[model samples]
Target: MTTQPPPRASRPALAPRRAVGSRRALASRPALLALVVLLAAGLFGTAPASASGPASAASAPARAAASDVVAQAPGPLVWADEFNGPAGTLPDPARWNQEVNGSGGGNNELQYYTGSTDNAALDGSGNLVITARQGNPRGYQCWYGTCQYTSARMTTAQSFTQAYGRFEARIKLPRGRGMWPAFWMLGNNLGQVGWPASGEIDIMENVGHEPGRVHGSLHGPGYSGGSAVTGSYTLPNGQAFADGFHTFAVDWTPTSITWLVDGVAYQTRTPADTRGNPWVFDHPFFLILNLAVGGNWPGPPDGGTAFPQSMVVDYVRVHAPGSSGGATGAVTGLNGVCLDVAAAQNANGTPIQVYGCNGTAAQVWTVAADGTLRALGKCMDVANNSTADGAPIHLWDCNGYLSQQWRFTAGRDLVNVAADKCLDIPSANTAPGTRLQIWTCTGAAHQKWSPPAG
Candidate 1:
């Protein structure tokens, strides 16, 4: 059972939890009164808002205005919150709510969820704590009779749901027998047909028993756990999970959702895997945070499991394309695309085609972290290593071969390693098949290609 920390001067208060996986969604609840007071009192006074852009007065950090909540990686931050205060006071209620009962949720777990302030609360030290405490046995009750345990489930439903964007969270799991902590999302269109049909994205999930590992999984028609598309990573040995917090992320786009832990990506899934099952991930989904006691997946809590155990949520964030709808990074700048056996199937000697960006073995390209592109396990060399115009680009095994390394100048021109010849876009801006030839190094805009953003 969670031992309450010694009480200090009273501070503020927040949300609650649930046992079922599909409890609540939508992360748009209004900030509670205590949270507002703490915020005004500058609990985050100098701390930077969890978001990426300029800090606004309304969303001041509960700590210091200059203190940033966390680090940022790829994509732009659209929304986020660092629970830097105690439990009780959470983000605004207008953004969140608790889901009651099973709305045909993806998981077949049992539990009728309810939203109660008691389930979620803030402890004095800056953590949005969600605790699952054992409740006294009531009866075969529907209306407050016999109850064994209670927890919190929070979500961003009414306000901040999005389709095709990266969503992430930094969290510390409650270490106890039976404790279940999850950061996930469900398709926003659940009011109609509901689960599998609605789609579910599990960005991060951990059972108390196995604290050092986390799983990134997806569930849809024909592919739920036991057979769902899933991947997991274990932390370095001796690194206790309770030691610190880690960031878990999912980059959701029209084509796929790439999963990353810390900054390294480990898994990616595509629509093809579903056999055209209708990718429901292409729509908006509400964010959800919950801590549960027992479930079919982890089975029931073990004897070692303790009650009143709390999970600490640091923050949740989402990023999307910029207003101009422009690309984020350069595509040509990429060394070569990683391709799998399926992607490598091209007529021998046919020029390679640029397919969607996937981390698949086929699509994996080695770009020098310093900025040179390598392709097909070799440097992209100008045909004949020539510096003259109309030089064809060819692939040869590495020999430190001058013909093999061609540097892309500011313009799309590829500068030959052997000579100064540039890889020019013949008749620049032609259709996709236009052959790439070498010419004098001339700075032109047509030679550059930026990878489209998320």
Candidate 2:
């Protein structure tokens, strides 16, 4: 969870136990409010007037169509929070741990986060409402002095963590200057590795000053704070995201992380995008949701600002690997030859090769949701985790290693995640026992493959 900046400055290092300060600037309050009012009235079609209202029925079809276009993860639902409890109830204690603090979020923020239902609670209508209200009634002392605002920040750190898959949430953001709402994630090893080093994935963050835009960012060792790798999506026609609900999601794979809003992909980051810095995202991470008031990036609320602003959430969901859309059959390459394990071997380091398709057990391959290609109870792996051309492909025990990950590109190339290379048939050889290797992706016939029909 972090703040938005005018020049993409450093964001708050948001975690349950710690806060790190950073500065950022945004548009003047009056101009932003005017823009938001105009956009909300003109661009929001059939959307609810307020976050507390029920979802519009007329928008269901469009949402479903948009979902159909999204490249959904081939997995089953592993975790979710629908917030269907009685009104005024807290979030499920089993899944969320609400943080209580007056630490200012390290961004010079004004809100003192609390575990009270007044700050965060479930509506009878299936939504998690995180409200930012004026006046801290608890007499909480903040970093600077007495707290002037109160809000809620919740996390799934103690309940769940996953390495790779789909993480998403549907949220209706709050508006007014100084309101900052976010749905994000942090590495589960945060206690050990600490901020930035533990990695931060800001799936969606919207500052009140920019009601029409939301940002997605990645923070790591060298590219953290104001220097984080980030991108923003602006609603067309000056539409304010606060006018309705939008789904924010990230498809995290072994090699890439793709950001999507309302089912449309806008940006994708790969290991290569790190600028030679270590990619620290290949590990388990937990989720966080918060609505902050008056931070460094958004400044403080002005005269036009309203009280009891709520960031309403419809749901938060996670999908596990290999729960859907996988095939188990012949994985054919050039000349329709099947990818096979030598001698039907199940031992580690057994060569993976090309052989005439004979419907044999050795030819059977399963495209796994975690990006690994499996056969004979083993994954197709790079020999010695090598990136050099002609590094042999072999069978190894199924492990969540970058060397074992593969992505079937639109161009039909089977690329390795760790090596950033292609699975190749050396010399374009058609021999039945030709061993496969990792080579620079060349878009050649020898590097093409057709995975089994799903």
Candidate 3:
């Protein structure tokens, strides 16, 4: 396979986003496949908004069915990839970034993951191949045995990030004991706080033994593995996901994340899921592709398992809420204003840092007239009615909280009813070195903020 040059990075253009439009028809419910170890933590609401309305609604739209009737939905390609060509070449670094470490090897899985070329390669014949080979010293040791395996983990971590949208991958799995393959996403802010806090979305995960079933899950502090908010599905009679390529996906919005396989809905969740820990899925998360050998979920490779197995990926595509060419945006708290760190990638519990308005896209944000603060396609809200000078602005599981509520008055000033204050970065200093802090309602220059025009 030939290595392709990463696409030239450029400032994305600002274009109109195509709305999902009126209600979506529900798809027949698929059986839950992922095991959800829902923590004893309190139960939260479904989603923030009606699938047909603003981001602050009380309930999310029901899962859509392929044949179910729907409103006039505008359809044009948002993003897609068709795996084609030879093997041994690397994926476009611009489009796909590999994770270098195991990050404590989440899932307790045994495979050592190197975002390296050896484990992940493109086969010349229309597929991105990920191979799990045994007896590699640089690989991880299994929790079940002495088996050593090398695998690849690829993601769009540093390059492209998406918020509310549809994410899908076409692929076939390798059948054998202890093999784990997944197409998932993690909040881009993970480096700041860490797992369960940054949030995780697993669109599909399959083990060797579960040939006919695929799993979908959402992980956060309060709800995660052993305590994860998960579900699964089994294909129609005698059909195995490992038998061939099938579309696995999730429709994400500011309010909820919906799971599907071959157009069948399995489970859905909203921000309120974070009532105790807050469902942290409502933000910019990068996509991940990996093939692991053994872990907590799939168990370990036994005597019957095979080595040198391969997971084939046909392609991956990301679809956002708006029209093509439109820029999707998010406001990351870098300045001291939010107590968020500089390039730290904050997760669920990271302290909100305060910094100056460097006018960085990470800090630039827009709020729709409908009250949805559309940054990375997720809503940004004040945490717990905090009007204190050090109030923390967090990305909560979108529950129509008055605390999550805000209004952009006269098109610029961000006024918060819960806090009775406007979004103002203290000590209005635009220098890259200044810290952005929040203060009481002063209606002064420090409180004035003009969002960059799209």
Candidate 4:
């Protein structure tokens, strides 16, 4: 699929990408311990990618076992589309860019991708239904066999791309021979640096031929194509992924990439885990989704395979750190109490104060992708939406108001974006009932906060 010639020396060599080769990697390396802890949305910096680095070997591959799985919650919601739109509607054009072609998807796939609602649309029940149907409804011909199927493929290329955090989606996969559904990512520099050099993360790939297992992989310079770093997790309960909706996610950071199925972390790949290839995941990357029919990995569809197979998407979201990387979770101070909403109430002016940490929803805080510190799906706001200093903190409904945006400073302060003030503990008071207030940032010890561990 390298359709373009290497770019001129002055330009990045970005172009089309296809599977590297036909060899499958079954190499073994140290397996990652289950990441049982949840990722906290702290404002932290991610590792930067090197524009030019020497390639490395593929001697060690990432690995994980079923017994090692652990459910790890990704931090606060960043960007999401619940597909909660009117039935038969196309996905949010603001978030998705659909592909329209039958060029075989570089894998000899037999599906003609169309922008028609018949192939991809929303179900009234809060889900994105991508269906693969039999016959050439569009009368698309192929280079080889008659085009026998049609499906939809889409990407977030025009919407968003972040360095790292948690990227996740809940999907009910399709099954039967030849059905290849994937949730993956491609580096944003794809138009500049091309594939392999830009990097790719396969969060989840399930071919109908293997209904019981899903794969997680990384593709780059030396690890592209047949030699990609790959690992998998099999459902322990003797169930197929197509049987129901399940979450597929990745806790991605500057140096490591951990894959999870339904919150259970199974594969963890780090720079050292690359076995020698240059690490290309340090840059921003966009997401892609498609139910490819008849690809190299799963072969072609057969009589036993069913048409009209679908991949139902519940949601797709991205969670990044606030700014200080304070790590996502309750922000605690003296007496080990956490910043909390009083009585689990949800109101426009519900007072927020320091409370003894009890692990209740009220005490749980998250630095969401939008920079809002949230508790119980509501945002930490300035009382009455005021921007004045001394305006007390409150729990309020999220309305995308500037008052809800917060910043975690390296100085351990939570600064409100609207007023440009710090979340202050009045008079250095260590009392649990002391309400949270906005004050001038003085780098005071009380102004510092701690987020939860990964």
CA lDDT scores, all candidates in order: 0.52, 0.75, 0.55, 0.70
- Please give, for residues 1-454, the per-residue lDDT of candidate 3 as tens digits: 1112112222111000011111122222322111111211122333232222344322322222222111111123465556564567887776776655443253455666665667888887878989888776654444445546678887777677878777878788888878888888777776665655777788888877778877777767766544566667677565777677777877776766667664444556666554577767667887788888776557788888877888899888776553112222333222334222344443432223345445454454454433334343344555533445756555434444444445333213455534445665546654443443345655475565433234
lDDT of 2: 0.75
For candidate 4, lDDT tens digit of each residue in 180-225? 8989988888767666688889898888887978888888877776
Q: Count the backbone clashes (under 3 Å) in each candidate.
A: 86, 3, 62, 16
Off by over 4 Å in 4: 1-75, 322-454
Least accurate 10 contiguous residues by lDDT in model 4:
32-41
Give a tens-digit lDDT track for model 1, residues 1-454: 1111112211111112212232222111112223444564476454332211233566432221111111112356678776555446654566566654322122322233455555676665666777776653322232233546666677787678888766877777887656667888877676554455667788887766667766777777665445456666566544646667777777677766766555434456788767557777777888888776655455566678766677777777777732212212324422332112233432222243344455544334343322223444543444433445775554434434334433332123334434445555556534434445566654565444433222
Stretches of model 1 off by over 4 angstroms after superposition: 1-73, 84-87, 100-114, 137-145, 322-454
TM-score on alpha carbons, each prediction: 0.54, 0.60, 0.54, 0.61
Say which prediction, candidate 2 or candidate 3, comes out ahead on TM-score.
2
lDDT of 2 by residue, 119-185 (tens): 9999899999999999976799988899999999998888899988888898999999888898999
Ranking by lDDT: 2, 4, 3, 1
* Cα-lDDT of candidate 3: 0.55
